[model samples]
Target: MMKARIHQRPKSSMQSGKAKVGQWLLDYEPAEAKRLDPLTGWAGSGDTSAQVRLAFDDLDSAVAYATAKGIDYDVVRLGANPLKLQAYADNFK
Candidate 1:
């Protein structure tokens, strides 16, 4: 059985504005353990599902897709994004 994870995307560190923070993402768990490649010594596996990332507008849509696809999934809910507002003069304190 395929397993997946659903979670909200957090604000990126590079941007001051929140973008796509409301989007939910579905990531498939790796079905097999990664093994070291003999030639390059890089970890890789035959399971391609781990590379797939599905985005949804909300949690319900993501969950619904998983349910309809018969994929067992776990949802990870995070607390609200913390935003601290302060005046420029506050930096002097």
Candidate 2:
């Protein structure tokens, strides 16, 4: 079984922006099924969307398959590409 996790946070310290981003993530469902985290306010209701996705596989073959399809790395090492979030969602299916 494979799993993908997506997280979204406000882009700034504005209630409106946080609400907007939260609503967007809540309503937007990518190709892969995802679980949304509870709405959390930081810096006193900020306006920013800090999102992330984690994809897991039990076997190397599965990881290879995901990578071949352009899936991003799960580990957050140096020089990690944020664009890989979509790739993870793409493989969620």
Candidate 3:
């Protein structure tokens, strides 16, 4: 008999700067580019959040896609959009 190895999925952390950017895009950006939130469940009350990254191949493509999806601001707070968050990140870079 051959032994099988079990692989585990990595835990998602919002503490990482990369993750923070992804979260901002998912939450505030339009919608299309937002990836399904990795942390959602049937009994969880709502759909999982989504995420996006600045390092994506095409910024314009991502923005266009997101815009077509009809942005949702349910989880986003006032004065906290992707544009502003991105600006903040640039400062650190």
Candidate 4:
């Protein structure tokens, strides 16, 4: 059976924008074995599903996609981080 992961995108610590925080991402777990090419000594897989990343505006939509595709998924929920409201003058202090 194919497994997928559903999780809300975490806010970037480097910036204070909410561009991708509200989005949920669905990622497929790799179910295929990676084989090394003897000529190049490189590992790769032919499974294209592992490379797919589906983004949804809501968690329900992401879950629905996995259910419709019959993929077993594990939802990872994260609690909201507490924010310390600071002003520009606070930086000087």
Candidates in order: C-alpha RMSD to true structure:
1.6, 18.5, 16.3, 2.6
> How high is the lDDT of residue 92 in model 3?
82
lDDT of 4 at 24: 98
- Choose the strongest candidate by lDDT: 1
Local accuracy of candidate 2 as per-residue lDDT tens digits, 12-92: 544424333331111112344344546753232221222333233233544564457554424222243354335556777
Candidate 4 per-residue lDDT over residues 18-64, each given as its tens digit: 88898999999998999999999999989988998999999999988
Deviation in Å, model 2, residue 44 alpha carbon = 22
In candidate 4, which residue pairs clash?
none
Report lDDT per candidate: 0.94, 0.35, 0.34, 0.92
Mark the regions of model 4 whose C-alpha exceeds 4 Å error after superposition: 80-92
lDDT of 1 by residue, 1-93 (tens): 999999999878998798898999999999999999999999999999999999999999999999999999999999855878789999999
Q: Could you tell me which residue pairs clash in candidate 1?
A: none
Ranking by lDDT: 1, 4, 2, 3
My TM-score estimates for the predictions, one after another, are 0.90, 0.20, 0.24, 0.75
Candidates 2 and 3: which is better by lDDT?
A: 2
What C-alpha lDDT does candidate 4 achieve relative to the native structure?
A: 0.92
Compute the lDDT for candidate 1.
0.94
Supply candidate 1's per-residue lDDT for 10. Answer: 80
Flag the better candidate by TM-score, 1 or 3: 1
What C-alpha lDDT does candidate 3 achieve relative to the native structure?
0.34
What residue runs in model 2 are displaced by over 4 Å at the alpha carbon? 1-58, 75-93
